[model samples]
Target: MSQEIESGELDALLPEGTVVRIAGNNRTKWDLVGKKGVVRNAQTLGGWHEVVLEGSTSAVRVQRNALEIIAIIPHSKVKLAGSLQGIKSGDQSSITKRRKKKQSPPMAVNLGKLDEDTLRRYRRYFNLNVRKDCEKDELVFAVRRHFARTKVDESDVIFRFLTRIGKFPE
Candidate 1:
């Protein structure tokens, strides 16, 4: 089945609950949802964070945000959430070099450590219910949709959302 998926014809036909590898030229794989995930700018970078959703080649990369690499995971994979540690400060240039040496893949991070105050702020501003078990991407999309509808600045809602999900500023 993995072989068939690698062949590309069945890429679009991949079943909803199936686990597929997402990577770039580096060959480091990140898990992704066949649907239900939203790609957006990480609030800190001001339009630099993006999760590319394509068949077989999906990846998350930092362009204008930071020198780090990011991986987007489905809410169902929250089990892997605890590993989402943002790149250490000043380590941006080393990500690519480390990859070239076949070093261990970047760490995955969990979103549960966000401050309660930040979470409350997000909930109050967006009218979202960001309970402790809520999925990160779901909260992000909810805020994105709300901002789009109300013509509000993303800063008003994005910071609190990212804090909850454990993603760093762009």
Candidate 2:
């Protein structure tokens, strides 16, 4: 049975929980060549993506270019509480669960790592008001607020960032 889906539903950068098949010609990952797996992490290290093979608990890292996206697991299934059945939360010494930090989009998306000057420059490019005397945190917060206020496509935001950083030709 073919599980082919519409190309419009797929994106080049696979999101987490996206099912994928390793390419047959993937010379580096010959052992698992042509195997199917679900994406656990999109960007584990540089261009590497972590994938969990069928019937496996442990995940393996595969190059992004070597994987072909099969299907995207709906957000409803992925966001249903915790999905891990047997994996430990890694708090052996503590009895209480660790509270997840409340973060804005800038911190959530790692935009805080960018220097204040760079952030200010990008804000200017985006037509965001920036004060020369304002703190770096405030600038980052504004960026977070801008996205959080609207229903913006994350991939588009990432693409814009890449273009601003000159990583991609405009």
Candidate 3:
């Protein structure tokens, strides 16, 4: 989630015609991330801002944190354009779209560097035998698969574990 913004500040900052990206977990009617939209109008409704996305008949009421201003277009220059038009305009021949990269296998974890408490927590959370003499790469692969299945963000989990283990000072 993006940082929260006050209604007054948002109103002042994002006048009509500001181009914004849907950084928050907002899905459009098409069931896709809204991706990009121009601010057609802004209104203060309770604690939320009812913002009208360009080309849409309905407006979405969301907190300031839900909206991220990508570009501020002057009201005079606010033209109804497709979301991808800006990206398509620049150096057409030089631009080449590439397929998404594949995710490599997780790297091996150094169990020796982990303290006893950290190791215990890792075992408890991942339900693995830490004392296993098997390949470290295999353990890492299993842990990665578990995390993927649970939809856990690896960086956040690792950071919390490190902080708890005193690797990162409070």
Candidate 4:
């Protein structure tokens, strides 16, 4: 038996470029529920409409009922705030040469060797729940372990932490 939904309803609810989250009892694909993806195309397939996600090389078809529209990706617009009359011509060669220079790798610090006072200061500044007796490596491990449990991206958390500590340049 066909359980087809109206094409009009699908068109009205999920327009192209609209970001959607998968929501249903499809156990194997539950990992996709919270992840946002842009709608590339929609087509009627048998009893259901299949949606293709952007940046997806495979034409994996997702049923219409599984999708929940979350957001729409906005196009960026460049606005000129001042007049371009006073702008001077820059040396293109210098700009190109600068781009060719290789950046130095970041220096690695031995977290296990940090002093108690420094660790205490970091814990106080970042408002971390790390113990007073914990060494630098232990503190780092604890923070990462907590972050993993919280489902927060480690890179983003580290970036924010660095920014809060004034280690990240503005």
TM-score of 4: 0.29
Runs in model 2 lying further than 4 Å from the true structure: 1-12, 24-27, 79-170
Looking at candidate 2, what is the lDDT of residue 65? 67
Task: List the candidates ranked by TM-score, beginning with the highest.
Answer: 2, 3, 4, 1
lDDT per residue for candidate 2 within 18-108, as digits (tens), equals: 6667774444468888666677877635567777876676788887767765555665555212233332233122112124453446545
Which 10 consecutive positions of candidate 1 have the poorest summed lDDT?
A: 1-10
Error of 3 at 36 (Å): 0.9
lDDT for position 82 in model 1: 17
In order, the Cα lDDT scores of the candidates are: 0.38, 0.65, 0.54, 0.50
Candidate 2 TM-score over all chains jointly: 0.38
lDDT of 3: 0.54
| Top candidate, metric TM-score | 2
Model 3 spans with C-alpha error above 4 angstroms: 1-13, 25-34, 47-59, 81-170
Predicted candidate 4 versus true structure: per-residue lDDT over 1-170, tens digit per residue: 11233444444444555445556445327655544345555665532323343335343446666666544433342112221112222312111011234446885555556676766676677678877777768777665454345566789989999999999985
> Cα deviation in Å at residue 86, candidate 1?
61
Q: lDDT by residue for model 3 over 1-170, one digit each (tens)?
A: 13344444554535666566555644333342454566656555533444555456455655555666655555687654434234222322321123345456886655455555554556567777545554555555555566456666889999999999999987
- Cα deviation at 40, candidate 4, in Å, is 1.1
> How many residue pairs of model 3 clash at the backbone?
0
- Which should have the higher TM-score, number 2 or number 4? 2
Q: Which segments of candidate 4 are over 4 A away from where they belong? A: 1-13, 46-59, 73-170
Extract clashing residue pairs from model 3. Answer: none
**How does candidate 3 fare on TM-score?**
0.34
